[model samples]
Target: MPVPRRLFRAPSRSLLARLAALIALLVGALLVWTLSTVYEQRKLMHRHQAERELQTIGRLQAQAVADWRTSRLADANALTDDSLFAQAVARWQSAPQTEHEATAFVQERLRILQERARYSVVSFVAPDGTVSMGNSSKTVPDAEKKALAHAIESAAPAIVEPRRAPFFAFPFFSLMAPIFDGTRPLGAVWLVMDVRTSLYPLLSPWPTASETAESVLVQAQGKDALLLTPLRRHGELETPTVVSASDTARPLVQAVAGARGLLYGRDDRNTPVIAVVNAIAESPWLLVSEIEVNEAFGEAATRELWVLSLPVSAAVLIAALLLGGWQWRARLRESALKDKLAQNMQWLESAQKAALVGYYVYERSGDTFTLSPMASELFGLTPEAPVARTQWLAQVHPADRAQVLAGLDEALRERKPLRMQYRLVDGSQERWVDMWGEHDAPSANARMTGTVQDITERQRAEEKLGQYRTALEALVRQDPMTGVANRRALTEALTVEWQRAARIQAPLSVLMIDVDHFKAFNDRYGHLAGDECLRKVAKALARTVARATDLVARYGGEEFAVLLPATGRAEAQAIAEKLRLAVRKLAIVHAASGVATVVTVSIGVATAQTKTAMRSEELGRAGAQANAERESLHLIHQADQALYAAKEGGRDAVVAQAEAPSSTALVGSGAAPDPTVSPPPPRST
Candidate 1:
C-alpha cells in the first residue's frame, strides 16, 4: 500500500506537537514529585529503624548491667549469712594465738572465694574498717571507709562505685555485705572486682555487626558525667574522661539529666551520633547505645541517590522517545513500530528491576503465566518460557500454598483486588513476599495482573524484635534466685485467673506457705545453706502441686504461694497438706526449727466460694471486674490470717479459713479463734 501524504509530512511546531510537549513536561514533573516523596518516606523509615535498634541495644545493655549488679549483691548477701565463716572470724579475732585453726579457716575461705568468684580481693573487714583477713595483703583505702560504715549501718549489701586504689593496678568496685552475729552487726565481707575483667566486656558486643557502634556506661558526678567504661573510639585508657554536664549536645549528659529513648547528640570525639539512653535499675548510672550518624544512615543516603537518579533517568528516556517518535513519523512501518514497542518493554523491565518489584499476568483460560524477567527470577523459573499454573503453585511455600491459591481464586471469581503476604520456597531457601493483584478486565478475559515484593528482611527484623521483647518480659517476671515466678508474675497470674474464674463462676483457692523459723535457720546454717534449703522447698512445693493450672510462686523472703483455679476448700486443703508432707519427706535437718527435727512448712488455705463470686455479677461488667479484683485480694488476706492461726497453733500444720455470713468475721478451723476476731485488711498483690 502507498504511504499516506499526511504520514510523510515534515515535522512542524503545530498544536498537536505543542500539546504533546506540555503533557510530557507535566508527566516528568509528576514523576519527580512521586520519586521525591518515596525517597523522603524511605529516609524516615530508616531513621525509625535505627532508633529501634539503638533502643533495643540500650535496653539490653542496661538489663545486663542490672543483672550483674544483682548478682554481686547476692554474693555479698550469701557471704554475710555464712555462720561457719562468721564463727571463724569471731574466734580468730578473740584469740589469734590459741585459735590457729580459725585463722587458717578464714584465710582459706577468702582465698577460695577470691579464686572461684574471679574477684581481685576478698577480705573480712572489722567494724573500724580494718582488714582483719584477706586473700591478698592489700589494705583498705581511707577514702572507702565511709562506704564500709554505710554497709555496716544499713546491714545490707551495697555497691561502691568503680575507682582506682593504690594497691590495685586497674580500676575496681567493691561489693560489701555486712557480717552479723544474731542481732548485732560485726564487720563486713568485702568483694573487690576489677571492672576490666567483669563489667567492661558486657558493653563491648554490638547486636549487629558495625565498627562504630558501642555502648557507654556513664555516671553523673555533680556537674560532670563520668565515663564508667572506656569508649571504643579511645581504645584502652588508664582513666575515663569526664564530660561536662552542661554539654547539652552529648547523649551522656542528656541521659544523666533524665532524657531517655532516642537522642541525636555527639560523642567524646564531638562526632554526630544517633543514640538511645536507658537507666540501669537500682544504680546511679545510665547506658548509652550509640553509633556515628553517618555510619547509621549511610545506606539511606545511597538509596536517596538511586531514588533521585531514577526520575531523572525516566525523564531522559521519555524525552528520547518523544524525539525519536517525531523523527520516525515519516518512516512509519510495521517493523519500526515493533522496534519502538520493544524499547518501551526494555524500559519497563529496567524500572521493575530498580524498584525490586516483579510483575506477572495470569490467564485463566490457558492456565499460564506471562512473567516479566524480574518475575521469572523471583519464581526461580526460566525467563525464556511461560510458566504453567502448577509450576507457579509449586514455588509457593507448602505452609502458604493454600492461602495463595485461595486468594488467586477469589480475585478471579469475585473480580476484586487481591492483597496478601505469603512465603515462597526454592529448594532449601524460604522467602517472604508481599503481593497485590486485580482483574485486568473484569468483563472480558479472566486475566489477573499482580506485583510481588520481597519482604524477607522486614519479617526477620520483626521476629528479632519479638524475641528481645519476650526475653525482657521473662527477665521481669522471673525470680533470679529460685527460678520460679516472682511476685510480679504471681500478681499478674492471680489477676488473670480471678477474672477467668469470675467469668465461669468457678471457685478460686490460694495457699500461703511459710518455712518455720526461717530466720533461725539462716542464723544457724548461714545464708548459702539457707538458699539451698529454700530451693529444695520450692522444688518440693512445685512437684506436690499436680495440677497444670496450679502455680507455685515465691511470694517473698521465706514465703511461697500456690494459686489453684477451679478448686474447692477440700481439694485446696488436701493439696496444702500434700505440699507440707512433701517438704517433710525432704528430711532437711533444721535443728533451729522447733516444729520438727527436720524442716517443715506451715500452710494457710483460703478458697473464694462460687456463691461469693455470683454476688459480684449483680454489678455491671466493669463493676464485676473491679469486684473480682477486690475479692481476689480479700481471699489473700483470709489466707494470711489463716497462716497466722497455723503459726499460733503448732507450726507444721494446714489451716483452712472458713467463710462466714459477713466475710470479715471469718475464722480458721485448724485453731480455736475468738468469735470477735475480724478479718485482716485486704493486701495488694
Candidate 2:
C-alpha cells in the first residue's frame, strides 16, 4: 500500500501566504486570551484556599476552649453547687485571703490537675493572683493580670482568658475570665494554651526553598504586633531590618478597617514576599502568610507556555498547509487541560468562599503576583489589579507591622510556610484573620503560597456552647420543678462528699423527708393540685439543705432527700425539724385522711464521716431502716407513730427511728411491721 501523496500545494502567489499568516495570527491571539483567562481563574482559586485555611485554624482554636468548659461541666453534682469561682470571688470581695490558705488551695488544685493535656495547659489561681496549680512552662506577668482585670470589668459577661497562649521566648500571651456571684465579679479562671498547637492543623502545607517554610501568629494590639514564628522565618538569616512593628501591622489594620482583605508584598532581605493579611474572629489577632511566589508560579507557568509554543512553531513549519489543523488540535487539548484545572480550582474556591477562605501567591523575583476572589475582596481591589505586591501594603495595620516583619524574615530564612493570627483595627471595627504558607528558594528569590479564612461564627459558637453546657448540667443535677437536687442527684452528691469527708475527716449528714398522708392529699385534691402540694413540700426541703455542700433532691413520690457535707446528725436533725415545721405551716387541704385537716411531714437524720468504719451507703441504709422500724408508710410512719405517741399521747410532733434488723425497716403496727415504708435499694441514675 502507498501513502497518499500530498494533495494540495500552496498557490504560487504571495497573497496565499498572506492569508495563511492572518489565520496563524488569529490563532496566536486566541491562545493568549484563553491562557490568560485560565491563569486568572487559578489566581482566584488560590485566594479562596488561603482564606479557608485561616478559618479552619481559627475554628480549631475556638473549639479547644469549648471542650475545656465541657469537661468542667461533666461533674455536675459537685461542680454546680459550690462553684469554685463563685466561692473564690466571694472570699476575695469579703476580705483579704490569707496567703497560706490561698497558696494551699491553689497548690492542692495544681497537684490534682497535674495531668497534662495534649493541647492545652490547665491550672488554678488564687484570689491574690498566685499561681496555685499548673504545669505551663510559660510565665504569666503581673501586667497580664491587670489587663485581665480590666477586661473582666469591661463588656465580658463570662468570657475570660480570650487569647491564645504565646510561644515561649517568642511572645507571652493568654487570657482569664472572672468568676461571678449573680452579677458580682469574682476571681478569674485562667486558660493557657499555645497558639502553635492551634495553628499546626491549618498551616501544615506550603513547600519551601530547600523544602523549608515557616508560619507566624501575629498579635495586633494598637500599633504593635507580636509575631509568633512557628520556626525561625529565615534560617541562618538575621532578622530583617524593618522600620517598626507598625509597618507590618498597620497595613493589615487598614485593610480590615476597610473590610477589604489585603494581598501585598515586601522585600525581606531582598527576597520578594506575597502576604495575605486577614483578621481572626473577634480577637485582636491577624493571620498573615508570606508566599514565595516566583518559584511557585513564575517558571512553572511560563515553562508550560515555552514547551507548548516550541512544538506549535515546529509543527507550523513542518507541514505549512496542515499547520492550522495541528495547532488547533494542540490548542484544544491544552485548553481542555487548562479548563479542567480552572474548573477544579473554581470548585475549591467556591467551597472555601462558602467557608470564608482566601488564597495568594508571591513572586520571589520581586515583580508581581495574583490573589483569588477572597483575597481581592480582602483588600477591596478588583481582580484586574496589575501588581498586588507592596503597592497595596500601604493600608496595612500599623499595630501589626513589627510582628508582620518578624514573621516574614523567619519564613524566608526557614524556607517554611507561616501561620499567624491577629486582630486589625479596620476603620472603627476590629476584624480577625488567620494565615499560613511557605517559601520557595528554587525561584532564584524566596517566595511562598498560602491561605486565610474568617472564623467569627466558630468563635461565637464556642462561647455560646459554654453557657449552654452550664444549663444542660443544671438540668441533670437539679429537680425540674423545685430547683433542688433530685433523688438521683442527692445520691451522687453523697458519693462525692463521702470521698471528700474521708480525705478531710469531715462529717456528712443525711436527712430523709416524707410528707405525712401525701397519698390522701393527692386523692382528695386532683392530681394537679397534689403536684402543687408536693412542690411546696419540696421547697421546704430545699431551704433545709441550703449550705454550699448540701444536696436536696426529690426522694420519692411524696418524699425528698438531703445530703449535707460537713454536718453531723445533730445539725441534720435541727435542720430537718425546721423543714418539718415549714411544711406544716403550708396548711394544704387534705379532705381524705380524716385524722388531720392539713398536710404534714416526717424526717429521719443520719451522720457519718471518713473517721467512721461504716460506708456512707451503709450508714444511709441504717437510717432508712430505723425510720421504717419506727413508723408506718403514712406521714407518721416513724414520726406519725412517735407523734401519735406524742399527740394520741398529744398530736403534731417530731420523732426518731429506733434500731431494726432489716434494711430501711419501718415502725408500724406490731403486726409484722406494716410493710409499706421500707426504704428502696440504691441504684445509679
Candidate 3:
C-alpha cells in the first residue's frame, strides 16, 4: 500500500517551517555571543589602561615623597656644617656663664634659620639634655631631650617621629642636627615643623581627578597602622588614625608587610577600590593610590550598554526579514552557506597571521621547499615565492645554521619528527622561530610537512628572565644597605683564596675592622643617619683597598673584613694604617668617640704562611684539603684577637698578629687546643 501524495506534502511543509524557525534562533544566539565577546574585550582593555595609569601615578607620588624627605634631611645636614652657627655654639658651650653675647647671637641665628626654613620653632639643646636657647620659653619634653642627646652623640641629623608638642599641643615633626666644634659635641639645633603644612599636601589632588581617587602615606606602629599623612575621605589630617593590622584587606597592612602591585580591596570607607601600593624607598612609609571600582569602570559600562543594544536591534530586524521572505529562504540559505565558507577561509588566514605560524613542506629528493604565503612572508620573502631548501637555510642565522641542519638530517635518516628553535636574520632584524616537522608518509616523494612559529617575544621574555635571575643572584651576594659583599660571598671568596694561597705557598692576610663608638653614633643620630654613616664608611674602605685581588666585605653591623691574598704582616699593617687614616680623613664627626673627635676604625691584621707538613695518615686524605679551610678560620680568629687587643689598648690603632704553628699542627694531629695558650701582643700602628 502506498501513502497518499497529500500526506507526504503536508509533512514536508511542516519540516520546512520548523527548519526556518531553528535557523532564526541560531542566528540570534550567534549575534548575542559576538556582541558579548566584543564588550568583554573592550572592558578588559579599559581596565588594563586604568591600572597602568594608576601604577604610573603611584610611582610618581612615591618619588615625590622620597625627594621631599631627602630635601628636608639635606636642610638639617647643611645646618650642621654651618661655620657661623658652630662658632656661636662653641663660644656658648665653652663659657655659658659669661657668654651672654654668644647666647643672644645664637638665639638670633636660630630665629633666622626658623624663618628661612619655615619651621614652627627653633631651639638650641645643650649637651646635658637641656634646652639652652630658644625663641620660645616652652620646655622640651624629657623624651625629646633624650633624642637631642642621641643626635649630639651620633653627630648626625635626626628626624623625630611626628607627635604633639608638649606645651604648644600641636602636631609637629622635628629635625635635629648635632652641633660639633672640631668633632667635639657642643649642642644640637632643633627645628620643629607643622606636619599639616609641610607633608599632608602630598597626598591630595590625584592625577585623574575622580571623586574617589586618593593617595595616602601610612606607617606601621606596633600592631596598628597609622595614617601618617592625610586621608582624602576620612580621618583628621596629621592625627593618628589607627587601624588593626589583622585586616588583610587593608592596603596599609599589606604594604607595610612588603606586599606591592595592584590589588582589589575595600578602602577605609568599605568601598570597593582598585589600589596600587608602592613603598617609599629608605623610609618606613607606604604610598597607596586607590579609586572606587565603580568610578573606574564607569566609561566601560556605558560602552557595554551601547554594545548590548546593537545586537538586540539587529536580531529583531533579522527575525522580521526572515519571516516576511519565507518563500525565498531556500535560495537565500544556499547563498548564505557559500558566504560562510568564504568567511571561514578568511578567518583561518587571519588566525595564522595573528599566531605568527606558517606551514611548509620539504621535498628531500627534489631539494625543494613549498611554503604557504604566510611562511614566505615570515622569512621576509615575496608571498608565493618559489623556495628551495638552500634558500630557506640561507635565511637562518649563521650561529644556528649548523644545529638546524643536523636536526634536519637526523630526522630524515631516522624517519622521526624534527623540532628546533633557531634565529632567522633578515637585513638588520633577527627573529626567533620554532620549527616542527614530521614525516609525510602519504606522499609519493620523500617529504616532510610542518609549521614554523615566530617565537621572538617568547625568546626575549626568556632572555629577560635570565638577566633577572643573574641580578637576583648578585643581590643575594650583596648587602642591601651598604652595597658591599655580604658574609656569604665573603665566606666563599675566603675559601677559594685560602686554597689558592696554600697551593702557591703565599701568605693570606685578613683585616678585622670595627668602627669606633658605632653604638654611640647610632644612639645619637637614629637608624637612618646611622645607615648613611655606615654606607660612607664602607665606600671609603672599599676605595682604600684598590687591589682587585683584595675583597672588602661587610662582615656584620659596624664590622668589616678585608681579605688580602699574597700579602705579609708588614704590608697588611701598612694597609691597615692606610684604611685608618682614610676613615679619619673622612672627618665624620663622632662626638661620643673616646679615641678621637672624628670617626675612626680599629683594625686587627693577621697573616698566615704555609710552613708545616703533615703525615697523610695523620691528616687523613679527605682532611688534607680541610686543613686549608681550618687555617683560614684560624687566621680570622687571630685577627679577631688582635682587634680585641686594639680595642683594649684604646681604639683608633692597628694591631698585627702572625699565625701560630701550633694551631696548624693541632689541626693535622686532629687534637683540640688547650685553653691556656697566651695570645700574641698587639703591634700598634
Candidate 4:
C-alpha cells in the first residue's frame, strides 16, 4: 500500500495531461483565427459582389434618366427646327388679332403634340416667359419661369429640373425650346412632364429580385439634397423631400456631393445601406442604387455560423488544408485567365487596326476625349494625350466644322446614335472619315463612345458613281438631238402637274404640236435636213413656253407637247398660236408643204379646270394618286383627239378642247384643206 502511493503520483501521467491541454488550447486558438479569417474574407467577397451589382444598377438607371432628359430636349429641338411651326408661332406673336389661321394652326399643333407625345401640357411661351398658347392651360408656373427665360435669352433648348409645382400634386419638369425668326428671338416651346408618369418608372425596376433594393435620384439645392424621385422602398416621399447636404453619411447627400462608386452609408430612413452613386449625364441630378446591409450579408452570416459550430481540432486542420489547396488552384486559374485575356486583347487591337477603325470615349462634361491608338491615329493626334473638344473640332475640315458640331450637339441632346461622314484635316492632307457614335451610361462621367474610320477612298468612289448616275439620268430623260424632255419625261411631268392641279384646284393645259408635212419634207430633203428642221421647231416651242414651271417635250417623231400648269384655255390657246408663229417665222423652205410655203406646225390645245376639290379622305392615298394619274392620261387623250381634229380640219391650224371641241378650228391663213383627210371623232368628256 505504501509503494502504491509513489506509483499513483506518476509525473509522466501529469506531464501527458498538461501537454494534451496545451495542444487543445493551441487547436482552439488556431480554429478561432481560421474562422475569423474565413468569415471576414466571405463578408468582403459578398460586399464586393453587392457593390458591383449596385454600381451596375446605378449606372443603368443614371443612363435611363439622362436619356429621358435628352429625349425631352430632342422633342423641343424638333419644334425649334420646324419652319412651319416657327412661321405659325411668328405670325401668332406678331399679329395675334388678325392672324386667326396662324393661331388655329399653332393650337392644333400643340394639342397634337401633347396628346401624341404623352406630355402633361404643351405650351408656347412668349419671350417674356408668359404663356401665349397651350394645349391644355395657358399658365406658366413661377417655378418654370427661370428656365423659360434662360431658353429664350440663350436662344437654345434647356431642361427644367424636377420640382413640385403648386399646380401639380407630384413633381414636374419642363423642356424649353426657344423659337427664333431668323436672328430674332421669338419665344420658346414649353413641354411639361409629370415625373410620376414619365421618369419614376425608369428607376422603379430592379434587375434582380430583392426586397430592399431601390434606385433614387438626388439633386443638390443650396445646402440641401433634394430627392428628385420618390423613394421606391419607403413609399411616397413627404413634402420638401430633402436632407442636409452636410450629412455625408446619407447616400443621397453623398451622391449630391459628387461622390461616385460604391460606399457604405445610411439611407433617408437611417437604415444602414450599401449603395452605388452615379451622376446623370448633362444634368444636375445623381442616381443612387442601394440595398439594406442586412439583406446583402445574410448568406455570409449563415455560413459563418456553420463554420463556428464545427469541432475545433478537425475544423482547424480541414480549413488549413482547404486554404492551401484553394490558393494553389486560384493562382493557376488566375494565370490562365490573364494569358487568355492578353490573347483576346491582342486580337481585338489587331482587328481594330486592320479595319482602320478607332474607338473614343468623350467626356461631355469635361469637353474632353480619350482616344485609343487607332482613334488617335485617325484624328492625327498623339496617342498618349487626351483630346480636348476644341482640338477635336479643329481636326474637322473648315467646311464640315459647323455640320459636325451641329450633329454632335443633336446627338448629345437626344442621347441618340449618330452616324456622319465628314472631311478631316490630318496634317496637310484632307481625308474623308465616317464616324458612328452612341451614348454610354452616364455613370462616373457623361460620355459618348464611338468609332471612326478613314473612308477617303470610299467617298471618292461614291462621288464618281453619283456623277455617272446623274449623267445617265440626263440621257434617259432628255432627247439627244432636240435637247428637250423626251416622251418618258413628259409623261412624268404630266402626272406631277395633274396631282398638283388636283391638290390646289387649279387649271392645267396641254398643247400638242405636230409638223404638218414632216414625212414629205424628210423625203424631199433627206434625213439630215429633217433632223435640222425638227431641232428648229423644238427650240421655237421651248422658247415660246418660257415660264420656269412650263415644260416642252418631244412627244414623238415630228411631234411636240407642252405642259402649262395653272393656265386657262384662253392663255393656253394664245401660247399655242405663238408657238405656231414662232416655228413658221423660221421660214425653213419646204417645197413639199401644202399648208404654207415655209415650214409650219398644227397645234392642239386642251385645258383641265380642276375646280372640283378632292375629298379629304382621298389625300395621301396610293389609290387616289393612281386615279389622278389615270385622269392625267385622259387629259393627254383629249389633247391627242384635238390634235387629230386639227390635222383633219386642215394643216397648220390650232384646235382647242376645254371639254369637247365646240368649233371646227382656227386655221392658218393661206392654207388649203387636205381633201384626203376626214374630221376626227369627238373626245370623251
Q: What TM-score would every model get versus the actual structure?
A: 0.58, 0.37, 0.52, 0.44
Off by over 4 Å in 3: 1-339, 442-444, 523-528, 611-631, 660-685
Candidate 1 worst ten-residue window by lDDT: 664-673
Sorting all predicted structures by TM-score, with the top scorer first, yields 1, 3, 4, 2
Of the candidates numbered 1 and 4, which has the greater TM-score value?
Answer: 1
lDDT of 2 by residue, 251-295 (tens): 333333333343444434545444555554545445555544454
lDDT of 1 by residue, 1-685 (tens): 9988887875564655566556556655655665565566556767777778778778877887897787677678878877877888788878989999999888866765674456877887777777744354444776557777788788787777876667677889887788877767778888999988788877886757898999988888886888888888786544547888879899888988888888899876889999988888888888888899988987776876685576468666755577457545635433444554464466556555655578888787888988878888888887747789899899999988888898888877788898999998867889888888878775656788888877777789879987877776686677667888876678778877776654454567899998988878989999899999999999898888776677898876788899988687888898899899999999999998988999999999988754323443355667666655666677887897799799889989999999523332121121232245332222222
Candidate 3 local lDDT, residue 68: 64
Instruction: State in Å the error of residue 394, model 1.
Output: 4.0
Models, CA RMSD each: 11.7, 26.3, 13.5, 26.9
Q: State the local distance difference test value for candidate 2.
A: 0.50
Candidate lDDT scores, in order, read 0.76, 0.50, 0.75, 0.75
The list of candidate 2 runs beyond 4 A from truth reads 1-355, 360-434, 442-445, 458-470, 593-596, 612-685
Report the lDDT tens digits of candidate 3 across residue range 1-685: 9988876545465577678667767766665565555556556756876787688768777876786677568668867987777987788778988999888778756764674455877777766756644354445776677777778767888777665644456777787788888888877777788877767665666644588888888788876677776676665554456778888787777776677899888876777889999888877878888888888887776866574555467555656565555556677755554554454344445545645678888888787788876788888765555577778899999999999999998988888999999999978999999899999785456689998888787677557645755665676578777998976678778777765554445567899998988878878877687788889999999988857778899876778899988777888999999999999999988888878898899999998765544443666756765765666777887998799799889999999976656335223322322234322223233
By summed lDDT, the worst window of 10 consecutive residues in model 4 runs over 661-670
Q: Which numbered prediction scores highest in TM-score against the true structure?
A: 1
What is the total number of backbone clashes in candidate 3? 1
Clash pairs detected, candidate 3: 150-524
